[model samples]
Target: MTGRRVAALAAAFVSVAASAGLAIVAPAAAAPGCEVDYAVPSQWQNGFTAAVSVTNLGERVDGWRLTWTWPSGQQVTQAWNATVTSSGAEATASNAGYNAVIEPNAKVSFGFNGSWSGTNTAPRSFALNGVTCTGEPGPSPTTTTTTTTTTTTTGNPVPGDAMAQVEAMQPGWNLGNTLDSTGSDETSWSNPRVTEALLDNVKAQGFKSIRIPITWGQHQGSDHVIEAAYLNRVKEVVGWALADGFQVMINIHHDSWQWISAMPSNRTGVLTRYNAIWTQLATAFRDSPGRLVFESVNEPQFTGSSGDAQNAQLLHELNASFRDIVRRSGGNNASRLLVLPTLHTSSEQARLDELATSIRGFNDPNLVATFHYYGYWPFSVNVAGGTRYDATAQKDLTDSFDRVYNTFVARGVPVVLGEYGLLGFDRHTGTIEQGEKLKFFEHLGYYARTKKITTMLWDNGQHLGRTSFQWSDPELAAQIRSSWSTRSGTASTDQVFSARSGAVSAKTITLNTNGTTFSGLRQGTTELVRGSDYTVSGDQLTLTAPAMTRLSGSRAYGTNAVLTAHFSAGVPWRINLVTHDTPVLASATGTTSSFSIPTTFRGDLLATMEAKYADGSNAGPHNWTSFKEFDRAFAPNYTTGATTLTPEFFAEVNDNARVTLTFHYWSGATVTYHVTRSGSSVSGSP
Candidate 1:
């Protein structure tokens, strides 16, 4: 996720009529009119964050001043995107220099964090430039009212059965980071514009659907009018997918965070903008085939709301409004599949239940429920020692799927795992080992299949090289494609280790047969006799000591030989025959801003690093966990034979405090090192 600045507000007070030529002096027939939306998105025990949006409805203004009185005594602590000052229960917010000019019917918004006591009731009335706001738009010459009338067109009719249609959309793919890029244009994010060849390749790759996420805010003007060129361009891409016989889903992507997130405080303005965007979209695609799906808002979440209850209600309003607008647009949209997501697209039981209630209330058979899964929280980002697809990680996956399935699928509601992949994969693949990632995908595919839920792979140009139209890791891709229909045989560990300096011993691996019959093992083209080289008893496969020694010829460091374990069905399992000994670390000294420990890997691979204080408390970044996040707090450079402690790690550590560093290797070896920070200088010892 990209870092977002914490919005703040500066203290300022300006008289509404003080500015020369900026006074609220309008003709008798055309007095200034405005709309104000006050929202409280986040609230804690005694403090909360509130957002205010003011729309100049009657006349254009070069400078603006808005005043409101809080029902309860609330003190503004901080704010952003505007200047805010308070006296007693009265608050005054004026536009900042950059956003001072508000065109007629255009909105400017600001937010602030404040402390409150007793009842924190929102102010019922607001005044902009000394004129009371009506909380509704006033007539403006630039306002263009669009009226949609039913028109017949030649195209495939929408399918009546939404379940069947969604079923056909199995194994979907997202055209991510392109249109959804929060930049000036689709190519602004560096991903090439949508091409027919791209859709062709996606269809050829066995994906039945493509989720083209489009951000409309960047291309929208006053009254949230989408640029026709951009709209036609989006239609062209959707047409390409539809022409290729692929089910297409287009959505309001980053706009959810851009403006829709302010719905709680700016309900009227947000809804007005949201409705306009959808009305235009629905009207444009009204004649298209039912294969086109409309997701109300991508991961609808609100700020300036009291809590989850308010957030849920806000989402329901948006979803309901979207459904109503689309249905009223006529044509095939009346029966088109409308997809809705839970708050933040979460698969939690409570969120699922909330969505379920809304679905039942809608009682629309053409609606589908959706959520996103990026594996478990820890394993998703390779944090808190979640470097492997262990039981905890696996359980998190299964448990999440089970909840969504039971809540939606079991009740005759089709579910779409809108996006699925490791969260760390977004940073770049290889954060998790190749084998662990493959296992995670394989399990997810099989489980989603069994649960009868369609899954969409979220690719932001990382998994698949968009230019080459090829997967970066073909082996992992093969595992994923194979899991769609059948289960694959996996092992307890993909690696078998042998000491580089000692006599080799027999190594046993627990195989997850997954209903697949085990065949003989092979090294390159030579097949090994089962009894001589290996023995399989039930799920356990053991390699003979002689075979291990021969595989590790001369006991070389690192991987000596690669063996493939063949199965009767599904993809073959890869076993790396590695030879390694305990790793060694040496003391070093450097400034607190940068530090690295010289390491002798001795063929071992670094797994995770743990930092702790003498008092046994977690140290460094993400102090709640002893194991610091990989790639963020620390990173291993095997090529340089060194493990680096990132500056971010040093930023939070206490000065003059000795922190214990424990480096865990993949081969079950642990090496301890200690580092002490004194002002800008740091020193380490093994």
Candidate 2:
């Protein structure tokens, strides 16, 4: 599983500004005029990253080239969004294919990583297309002021009790993959534009708060000025949520990784842009009630820092600046509840401690600590043979929550789980088994409630259908809702497997009563007799042989029957009666470019695959673990009756080595096979 919450796009924008104290050279009247903003956002002992934005002030130019002479022996090591070449002390950058055109008064930006000597100073002069730039653009254009009318009746008055206000914002929902999308617009990620009706639908579903994650980089222009249209759109959505009585949270979403991550090197530029963003936002919503919360940054992380210690210090600086700007902006922001996150919004002990220190330093009671939880790594993405929500996953959750609870909640600092969901859910809901996914949510909700951490479900139009405004899995949604109030009983396994060719034996499931009493078990509307069909002793629910055989009608493969375990309260647990046998694998010959083991699943479902060499070392991609990453190194196609080993897996494995493959099925059956690769040719044996 990945450590970051969201996968960052490659072409993220960095903060840019013209270097001050740099000498300027005047160009001839016939020469085209240009202005450049050269900023180094990240710098270390010997390396640094720089972002450059060049604006054409002269006639329209179809293509542009920027040249600058390093004053302190800085060398361009690598670059992106533009092509940079260095010779001696001078360096030149040419626009990439897409950004080749520069309309009159328009700007284009690019970034690069470079090396520096003892003293890394900004370049003294810059020339665009052989013409020396004045370093200053023409007079500023007229700025339009959007006057927002303040309505006292919009939201509840700002509450003095921060803890109480945070508690009231329980059961939050995230409007993800919408405004936060880094594409051209909100709909760039295929989610519809935010509508008041959508907010109404979310409110109807018991969500008291909404997190609007907006990526402001793409919508910003030179000098880090956010476009008026984009700012207005965000305000419109925030207003809708507030009008619907939602505690709204708006933050610098993707921009955290985009530009904010360069704070260590470009502290001046990053802080300047960051302060401008918050100043505008604070000014816009200054009159709004306290329900409007401002999060400093989403998953704030710093690159090129000395270490975690330096990263923590950088985050503190940003948080401090954010708080200072918002508070001084006046109106409701003076005492408005502000949320600050640790590095990457992680719940680890170190990250939590750093956040606690920052909060204590602020000495503000209206402050809240924030973090994100995406479940345990392996089970989250169904990697490393972790296909179940076992003790390990449970312990991970409890330990994380316990640390945060002890560090903050117990000490009177409110905590908000800014985002919570399985990482695999982002790919597709079925990436993890339905039963295991449900159990995870059920346990997560209960534990978070006990810890007093408000969880905002990160729904990127996967769990909930945006158009229909209904959950794809109503049962999963119901379980999450129930977990908010009380704990729900769950079974060890939601499935019972019976061999198709043999006589069925009794199947027992360990129930986690979780303080709830089990009512009975039923298949559809027919309730099974307790003595004859099943028996419940203590926390064990056992299905007799006769009942198992009856449930496995015709001894068919796959799910034969679905049984619901009803509890005295909360949502019922589903128990699927499946008939499956040991899966069969066949030998095959192919090339490393493409290879697959013909499989006869025989009604069994594939769980995960493990690959190991003769030396007992891991093989294939993610070689640190014997079990290859799901869907990346290998994928099971039930319809094709084959398990395909992707080229990515073969690309990493030794060319002429034999690797043992173990296929694990959900039915608890494991099959071993061997495959040998010679050059590009491969052969498998069962």
Candidate 3:
């Protein structure tokens, strides 16, 4: 995802030596005839994305090469959809794998991201297959043939449950490189102009959502007021997408100048600008249907000399401010679904905690959590087809989703997958090929459907053609559509229970799930009554005294207990716990732990630790002990002698489950040193 700019030709002169009075030239026969559409779709001041399409009007060709020269010394830095080579001002592009063949009257295209100084212009002449094209070159074409058939918006009822709505929003597409371009014009980034026909094409292909990442900072004035013209343009594009029956998401994107991490020196101004931007957007879209969503920020994070604690505190405050501003903006804005991004939109466990903690206690049920997934970065982003699309890659994808589900979805919160995609690197062809792209899409689609997470694919004028109004790879497009329909049964409801004091006592309990009737819920074989038993509201189902008494046998599960397992001597073969029967929670491998059990499984659990060696012999699950029996300690700084660091070392062995150690020293005059632990050695910082 780079920026784009419109391509302009640098004027050049074609000359010949004046040897003879008159130079006689014979008219050529039916040589190769072609037309070229060279465009720079996105650009920054120094870089741009260049896209070219060549149509063969003459005989068929199995392979083709295009050669052009840059007068402004623009260098091709990276390319996709073709193999490109540059030497000085001249550049040549060869056909990649799937696009090698060009039938009569058919077209082939490729693109590249390039850097420039002075001026950026398209080559004056393009020689396709060594025969110069006949089409005149200036700016690229502005329109595509629209389909006669159009589908109107259904104005579907907005589901009260955010997660349910997210599930309904299946496969999605991004209008990337166009609006999100760092350059001036929307088309500066090499993508063709956005048209009604394009929106129609996307909806016709079964995409349920359109994510428009727009950079608004560049269009604002010194007073921070967005330009009227720019707002109108955004409205026009948004209207097109919504008219074509697509859910649309718009956000403030790529504003690096104003985006700073949690630092007191810069935070106040950042929040002010954020409020200004969202207030305008919210007011404008207030009358639009509920399908229109406002994302607070693309990826919010701190920059320069900021610690994790400070950034975390700032992110929390920023998210709360975003929520308050939109709500106060009035109109439909009060109830409009808002998306809050985690730290850097990351899916890491600790980052998830940071996001959840920051936004906790908000009463707005319409708010949906969001994060970008580029799990196993190398495998998912800018990757070769060969390295990805394997079993390992599949595991990485699933594991990432599982973490998201456990972190947010398992609770009452809903999550939107704002961004996820394969970088589409085809090695042999130097263009996007089928196999890996299809597999990645399938995994994305299947995960979205099963996990009930909304997904949007990132496109940068490659996989799908913005000009042709057709998929560059038809099979890949079909795979995405097919995977969208591949889903399992309805997701199971996660219950929130309550505990009472006495046997057969009466107390109300709430079920934290999207609505179902009182009779719909049962404890073992007993059916509960409506008003006499429980009441329902959104995802909360509250049970009455009689119903609670009847359901007394069920333990109310709340409060998540964390399991911290530390390996010092050697890693275990496997970690196990027995309640109903022995179940292996995780297989140990590394020097640390990556396993956690739900807090609901809190009472009377037994840990059966086991280890296996390289020789294939297994150790015993010999340690059978109560989790509660483990010692929990707390101590303040105490000095034993003069001029010694206080509380030098502390260690705790929780049965055979985990071991934790810490060292502390007094900040002031008190100094002491000591170590507590036996039969095991340890080393590390305080």
Candidate 4:
């Protein structure tokens, strides 16, 4: 996810361990009327950045002490706040200020930059204020360091050799009907359902890779367009893959025709949206480390794959477009390899010896060209009528793909087989019988590495042996078994933010298929919010925030706010509106959900729904993606005897000639409390 899509700000959160499958090895303990809850940055890799947070669990927690064990290989080189005293792998810290006593259930947070081996795990054990805390893993930590290399071509390549690198990460499995309805190519591609449970099964069996050939076009406009809703949902699934620490490959999938068709005639516009999509996704995962990648297009076809000339022409254009888009995104995306399409994007005689150079401007160091392998019709296909099975054909097919990689070695470009599968139009399960499939897969796995090529089997998950894809039989067991056993690449992971709908048409408030409203979510009762800058009218909410943020080319992450309902409570509701790393201010149990407010980023309330019937099951624990933060006040105006607002802290103030107000903290700290002349909380909370 890191790439040109990386955000200027870090991914934000208070306690993300639950969402991340992380356990706080030690839960905090406290005296009656006195409580303390602590947190680390949402990202806790084996890095140099050190951070810790302590919240008064009950009464005010004035002084604090924290202790924990660091992972063996990672050690702290520098630290701040309290002090770092370590022995072997254990460390402890004591707060310097007595007032640092976190007030009642109030919270105080701190951090220091550090480094690690790029894995997601946290420090274990902790003693708060000299008292042994209970949780094993203390808290979620923030991420440190971002990989930002942006070279598009290779550093060292054998001249005249051609290379392609497919982002082959999905495990090999037959697809189902839900994926492909037309019985067309879209059918059962890596059915997440079947493959979801079978991933470990396939990996254990020896399958090295799986290609989730998703046909997103079905969800797009008739013109083969992509909708934000569909994209977000896809991201959710991708998130699951990443969390599993699996090597995942996400591309335009089968919507090549629609997606490529939308590519701007000018590389700028196309690159703009290209970076936009990746940026949104990347920013969400910037802090989490992983081996996931974005493949530009499934199979680009500017011109049909009629012959070599057309194939060459299409590849040239795709190469140019792919490079242009990669360099614009930042973070890991800067240097992460991007897979480009071959001329016809398909393997056919018409595409013999066809390839294109790495496009310029994409010199981010990690770019790979790609082509598919299938050869001619009947020979390439597993038709029920095609004589019997052909093991030799399968081997040759694998060799054909190897040829594409050979091309890369000659051209010095990293290349991969974007796709390779066999099927006949005749019988549903006719093409490439299960036995032939086994041979095909065996040859593929054997030759893949030498060819220096990565691959994705057209393992559409749902249908399987029911149709053209026949991986269900005993003969194909090894294919499935091997795939179940042997995995490729690295499977590191980090959490990613997911906005229900990435983009919404301006002025829309339905929260229907297009609009993704933040509702049906809260720790206790729920409240409503409007859009980014709209006001709430009855049940309708609208937002009023600015379109752009201080961050360049990046708009604010959360666009909805509390427009309608508010929470009372059994459990405190966690909220997150800003997509970047979250900052912990103060958290308490007694306060109502309505009492929580916001800062910089804003959200709109659509409608808040809460069902607190005794019979109703509590959401138990949850996280809020709302954009809310408490407002901090400034120093008093000297001569005017009035607190002055600097342009830095200026509010539009609606030109009321500026009515004055005081700033206040919920714990009633000596801090001045204030209400706007408009009767709004200083933090802008209603």
Q: Give me candidate 4's TM-score against the actual structure.
A: 0.38
lDDT of each: 0.80, 0.81, 0.55, 0.38
Q: Pick the winner on TM-score between candidates 2 and 3.
A: 2
What candidate 3 gets wrong by more than 4 Å, as runs, is 1-159, 256-265, 381-386, 424-434, 487-686
Q: Assess candidate 2 and give its TM-score to the true structure.
A: 0.76
lDDT of 3 by residue, 1-686 (tens): 33110000000000001110111011112216789899988999898998888887776654466778888998777776665756668776765434656887888888888889988877898777556787633221223112111100111112366766666566778898888777787888877778988888888778898999998878889888999998999999999988888878898877733454434577778778877888888788888988888887777656673444566677677778878888988887888888888766766444565565554446567878888764443343322112335666777678667657655676556788887765424221222223344556656777766776888877777767776878876756765676666521111112222333334333332331112122243433354455776665643455465655444444443222111111121111111111121111211221111112111122222111112222323211111211111101211111211111112112223222223211111111111112222234322211
Q: Candidate 1 or 2, higher lDDT?
A: 2
Q: Which candidate leads the pack in lDDT?
A: 2
Writing each residue's lDDT as its tens digit, candidate 1 over 71-185 gives 8888777766665667668776755434756887799999988888887899889887666899665555345233101110111123348879889999899998898888888
Could you arrange the candidates by lDDT from highest to lowest? 2, 1, 3, 4
Worst lDDT run of 10 residues, candidate 1, spans 5-14
Give the TM-scores of the predictions, in the order they appear: 0.77, 0.76, 0.47, 0.38
In the range 1-686, model 4's lDDT, one tens digit per residue, is 00100110012112111111111111122322322343444445454454566654444443345667767544444454443444456655544322235665565665545445755346755556444555332222122112111221232344331222232443333222333222333323323333344445444444444443445545645433456675565556555555555556556544455445444343454444444444454554444333555566665544233433444554455555554554454655555556666544643212322333233233344556666654333333321113222544654465456445434543466555655554331223323333334444554554565555665555444224332334454434444344333322100111112223354222323211111223332213432223443454534423223321211124344422312212221111122232322211222111111223222211111111111112233211111211111111122221222322222222322321222222331111122222222223233221
After superposing candidate 2 on the true structure, give the runs of residues whose Cα lies further than 4 Å from its correct spot.
Answer: 1-160, 426-430, 589-594, 678-682
> Candidate 1 vs candidate 3: which has greater lDDT?
1
Residue pairs in collision within model 2? 41-265, 41-266, 42-265, 43-265
The RMSD of every model to the true structure, in order and in angstroms, is 15.7, 18.0, 30.3, 30.2
